[model samples]
Target: MELALSVLQLAVRILALPVYVLHFLGLWSWICKKWFPHFLSRFTVMYNEQMAGRKRELFSNLQEFAGPSGKLSLLEVGCGTGANFKFYPSGCTVTCVDPNPNFEKFLFKSIAESRHLQFERFVVAAGEDMHQVADGSVDVVVCTLVLCSVESPEQILREVLRVLRPGGAFYFMEHVAADRSTWNYFWQQVLDPVWYLVFDGCNLTRKSWKVLEQAGFSKLKLQHIQAPLSWALVRPHIYGHAVK
Candidate 1:
């Protein structure tokens, strides 16, 4: 009887979280874009350099995925606090975007000052809005740990494809729910409620590669790994590059 009740409770646990997750997601979408900037500036470095550092090495074989790096015209959507800036090769001209109000003044200040591109804010193309950029002008579009927070993952990827030139590449790193692990499934199911609220709009189970494939990034070079600290439970991470 206790085991049956526990199973029933787990079932309820799974069904109940999304309601709150969706509700909190709405609240965070507004708060995250406006939350503390200078403070976040300092904090972003910790996450930027730490967790993102590990994820970056997964793309070490860049030549296989993104081609050569010189004279490249790249766009980074949801370029949170410019963590990915130093990772990009020198010759590449990057146009980066993030909607955070903090992003403009404090987060992307360095990006706005880059000599490589004539324009300011790099790309500043928010996921919720991508009409600002011209079609077929971009050589690479990157999303590192960003897609999990996008307002509409499907529409944002559509815009990514729209702007990228034929043969242009999409490089990405993200976390998703783990398959084959009951513990991971259980915690991802539990913490996801508070998770989406506190940590921006990031989802614990959004398989970004599948989302990319469905959005027509048909030529894909992909990798999947685990985050050292993804959730308190399952840290499933996905890393890959797809060509448009």
Candidate 2:
């Protein structure tokens, strides 16, 4: 049985070789960086409209984290197009981090539109390694729809912990793997490889909630719900906050 499983995995890898080649040539990254931010900007309109109430509730008390300047320092990892800017409290000093430099223009547009927020800077870096952000320098860290595509969720969470001040808050929302018995889970398992290739490394079967639960947060308030997205495969979502 083990040998059969190994053989199956090998076959899958062989089938995905073209994708690996494109990645090696940097063609896949280039294509995604050029187009994905534009796509996300369109998608964010629908997503934000649907998630407004929940986001408002989640971010309502950010004033609690405000410093002497009457503003809270916020770090947003994987901040594609700055979709969360409108949801943040006024006077937030936000530092945006994303691996793709191409998103900088769209991020600037969002920042321009969100006049209430104070733009700190935008860093081109991945979530796993944000050495650019100092230790315990941020009061809040926001991540949404990011873990599914990241190379390492655990490492990203570690960086989140490292960048947050004592008693800081980490807000997260992510689509997770479906229930084992459901047909959605079966399809997610079957389509994950192709999905990863097509959607810029997003895995449909990532159990991101499990990673967050074990991420050494001093306090965690997690809630699971079916997001009102058109895609059924990504409807199972977990959202909440964790305190450092």
Indicate which candidate wins on lDDT: 2
Give per-residue CA lDDT, model 1, range 1-244, as digits (tens). Answer: 4475467556755765764565557754555556645545776576565576665575454434344444667788887676666666555666767776567666447565554443334445677577888897788887877788777888988888898888888888777767745667655655565566656666776766777778888688776766666234536777778888
* Top-TM-score candidate index: 2
List, residue by residue over 56-76, the lDDT tens digit for candidate 2. Answer: 888887788776677799999
User: Least lDDT summed over 10 consecutive residues: which range in candidate 1?
Assistant: 61-70
- Each model's lDDT comes to 0.68, 0.89
| Model 2 lDDT, full chain set | 0.89
Task: Please give the lDDT score for candidate 1.
Answer: 0.68
Backbone clashes for every candidate come to 2, 0
How far out, in Å, is residue 2 in model 1? 13
